[model samples]
Target: MPNLRCCSSSSLSLPAESYIYQLCAAGPASLAAISSDNSLRRFDRSSLALLPDGLVKETHAAGVSSLCAAGDGLLATCGKDGTVKLWDARRAGAVAVFQADKGMPLLSLACNASSHSIVAGTELVKPDAFVLFWDTRSPGKTCRQYVESHNDDVTEIQFHPSRPSVLLSGSTDGLVNIYDTTVPEEEDALVQVVKHSSIHHAGFMQDKAVYALSHDEMFSIHPVTSADEDDSHADEVKAVEFGDVRPVLKAEYVVQVLVDAAGSYVASGRTSDRSLSLTPLVHTPEFHFEQSNSWMLPGAHGEEVVRSVLFDSESRTVYTCGEDGHVRLWKEEPASSAELSSIRPTKQRKEKGYKPY
Candidate 1:
């Protein structure tokens, strides 16, 4: 019902119901693409062409659940196989396999800028989940040991782009913890811990909110500055209710959230119609567009579950894919009439079942 339309459409076919678990842009042109559905497949940005380079077989013994690209054409994948693998994307060979706690599946991975060390997080099973720090410098070194971290299944992990020592992770157990890799022995010395729902996605935004996408269309914008610091919390929230909690903005179901480098705009993807809506952080209460573009990519796998959306700020090009095996690329444009839909305000808020405090 939202003003949603595909800016353009292209489709691809795949062998199975491939849910995109991870994505990374290759080369400086950002013209190359890599994704994990059944296996790692490379695609050409122009003409939505499937390139000859692809990992036909699944990355892990079970299935590839996550992926990340490090510098020098290095790639990492983790999944039900309970192992983390490092690969040379250009060479088409695996360099090493880092095993997780026996039987525990690796769900997520984050790489430092150099890609020498990787931080891996595992899915929650029962009593707890763990995050492992791996040294990938020596590919010949066969053995690996995991440092137990977190009280529940680690849902996601991320590394500070400039600082390798700083790491961030969220878990189903409602904990967001920061770790200092420099002190590998200090297992529980968290730089910061947040009590909230499992974080689906997270990234630093203008030294302000740490934007994250939860399971639902819900998006949480956590103010980076402490609540004790009023000078930082400027925007007044409209829809979502918090007991003076300043991190969250509109608590609607959001599949993905990305902030441009300049922090001028935030793009949050909506899963329902396969589109992303843009919200301006500078304007606060007035979010300009909702359901901006319908993402359509040909040569996609089955199912159409959107895996990830990567934005090239310089080019304003957006690359996204889902279970529908193919990845779609979109170029950003000004807000069209198709983006402005009627908002009942209070009525829609009530229908959302917002708890009035």
Candidate 2:
């Protein structure tokens, strides 16, 4: 069975009465987080120690909502103050800022590594919601604005890891839309749509599949097939719901869904319970729930809701941040040879109070 152990742990204190909302692995040994106190802080990945002179305090006038690690030592963040800021991780201030019209609240953010474009989603307004795009090289100017995609608040947005022109956005209206950003017009950019009850987060898995987490604690995976040359089969190109929807963490909500760097496992952070649960993706045909090789890291946040979990597969380490304004580190432990050899075979038997049906 898979073994996940908490080998060592450390915590870092942020500004007074701060609440962390998002966390991202900035580098192999470093992490970055955004908080309700309108601050962005960085820490050592292994020790969870606050890096001296590694803070950008009050960069946003309001609470920060989301964070992402852009390429080349850059960090991207969006805030309720209706702006997206790009910061150099080695420095203490923002290098560029992207603003929205009328100072609309920016709730979600994503950065495209291939095209060097930044996308920001807005909170719900009376008539419609919008997704703003900007070129990273030429900041402070709007490249395009998509206003007809979602009807409610835009909750999450992500760019395809391998495809530079593809983008994904999810909203509280229970719709997940995929768009081809290369198209010049907003009306012609939409490629597909996947509907659910209410979406909390959505992201691509290895470029072919997309996974979505709902507010009701359910998860679903969809498969995207290649388009057919024949026009008669064009409708068949829509994403097909591929697998059973299952409860991920059995909590009120799942803050985030994270896949390991090697794509070997998937994990989720649970609210109210303060735990991180992991499940191996590669399983045998005879796999049973009792032998599924899954484990939980309990007492993860100590009565606080864990907002984010980041994994480093190279070193087999995990980092988590929470509402308590603390970042914690967990390392895997290998089982001993003696402990494995001591196991004895068990005899199969029926339950004590049951009979054959």
Candidate 3:
């Protein structure tokens, strides 16, 4: 790993109590962010500065729960308001809105440009949770729904990197379900199911393996394949369980996985000394933990929990945002270790009632 130092940061413009939980690469030039303040903001990817007139003060009625890039400079955001909005990065207002039936609160969202569909997972409303899908071309029409798959709140949903018809959903019920979207029936749509913990973040890895990270830091990777694509696959694939990474990395929490062409990297953090590291999982002949190439961020978001991390392979830079309402940029230091110049965070507010939810 190259020696990294904090390079740039956006001004603390968010509500001081807000937590910046989501980040999306809006396009080549900009990145979009959503916080607990129920707003959407954009930053210049190069400078890490908030763009002028790039603030959407009210992107959602309730807390903006998630944000995802919808290809071609468009951004999508979901909320506790049970709605999702699409925006063009150049504009400050949302261009279109999609709502869940009976306004079910949505916690996770995914977009498939290849399939021309938007998928959002809802919090468990009563006895059941749902994954709702909307055709981008028909905003006013009702969405196709997938019910009876997960028993608890659906926390994450993502489209297959190569096959858009294959979608994955993870939930608080300790299950990750892969669905074939072309099938309309709920039972028929369900393809593969992997038992896991209460999933905090789960999705496809570069090696076509499925990774499930639980809220309590339990992490595991499982091989996945659709029946039609590979019917000879095992009925129940075993996982390479890396349980409770907090102890393994000496971290207070595991943020999220950032997967790029290089490999799949897990972003883990320790708040005690305010450190973060992106350690790649080597998946060639088999999965292996590689600590030698672990990229370390010495003062990640100070004592705040890092909610989102982004690595740009082309520029070789890393971006992070946290509960402290700060978005920071990091890059390799050019000078010797003695000449390192990572900036210190500003004095934080009293933690009387702060929570890293």
Candidate 4:
């Protein structure tokens, strides 16, 4: 057990058994633990007991910044060392490592729904934020890099649940861009860049400036992979957004929803109390994370905020990580449709002369 530094009412000191900053739930009873020492360990979710993975020391240079597990024994990790590495978790060895260009730190990573491809977002100190796409079939090889859209640091990247080629990314510049991998040269064809009014035109509102706003909104959608369109040559592919939209205090909390395998429910984490929020998989432009009502979890690293969140589709569990070095899991009782209906405030009821008959 490692000592964790926490503040006490009387004083600040390191305590025994400090929590790690990273966590991934491989199954209902299992989780992968990434310690500050750059070692990877698997633990039992119920008991938090370490499993016998034997300290995988592959990421020696940089602490693991991000991790994703592909359905079939595949695990991918990104490091501050400006590198992305793929590993065979079942074999416990490094499969391949890919390096990024100079001056960009690998900020976020995601594996396609098929788990055949991987994509990463990088921080841009010089020109603009960019994303790198990798064909994981060939590990340790070069990946296709794209930098055509973002003007700021790329903060979040998520692959569409059903469309392996479709990807969505959010950035500090307050822009969301969707990409299609099927396009030979994606820079040419794709959805128009979506910009939020509150974020892109934030300067116009002086009174609500302190309210955090949607400048750091993270996005998740239930993507439609393929459907016959009116044009015989083209297939209809789109993403449906649901749930509440939130104004996150930190830029990383912009988008956190995870679509269920059945395409029914979308699960997301709220920073306020670290509560798990669930929403339907319908087109809900009104579903925003209302800052005033949401719960925020305690900061993991001193005052450092949450950097990433993941979900287990099978168990319907949410795991979150932050700078505080604590990985917390949130589980809520499934809500019935009747319960959800009651929670929604009625517009007619809000009217001045509405009377309950």
Which candidate ranks first by lDDT, i.e. highest? Answer: 3
Candidate 3 is scored at a TM of: 0.91
Number of backbone collisions per candidate: 28, 0, 0, 23
lDDT of 4 by residue, 1-357 (tens): 011121211101112333244456565467675655566666556444555663476573756666767556556678777778766656757777777777357767787646478788777757767788777677644467777777776756766544566666756676666666676675754553555422211110011001112333424332222222322212221332321244333322333333333222222333344334344333233233333322232332333344345555454344655444555555432341222222221210022111100
Ranking by TM-score: 3, 2, 1, 4
Candidate 2 overall lDDT versus native: 0.68
Put down candidate 3 lDDT per residue, 137-241, tens digits, no spaces: 888434788888987999999998877888999998999999888887989889889898888889987435789989888899888867576644333444688
If both were scored by lDDT, which would come out higher, candidate 2 or candidate 4?
2
lDDT of 2 by residue, 201-319 (tens): 78776555666666654566665432223334233223434232234334433555565335533454454555666554431221112224455677777666666777765665677
Cα lDDT for residue 293, model 2?
A: 48
Model 3 spans > 4 angstroms off: 231-238, 336-356
lDDT-superior candidate, 1 or 4: 1
TM-score, candidate number 1: 0.72
lDDT of 4 at 328: 57
For model 1, the stretches where C-alpha displacement exceeds 4 angstroms are 1-13, 30-37, 139-149, 206-208, 223-252, 264-275, 283-305, 332-357
Cα deviation in Å at residue 40, candidate 3? 0.3
Poorest 10 consecutive residues by lDDT, candidate 2: 347-356
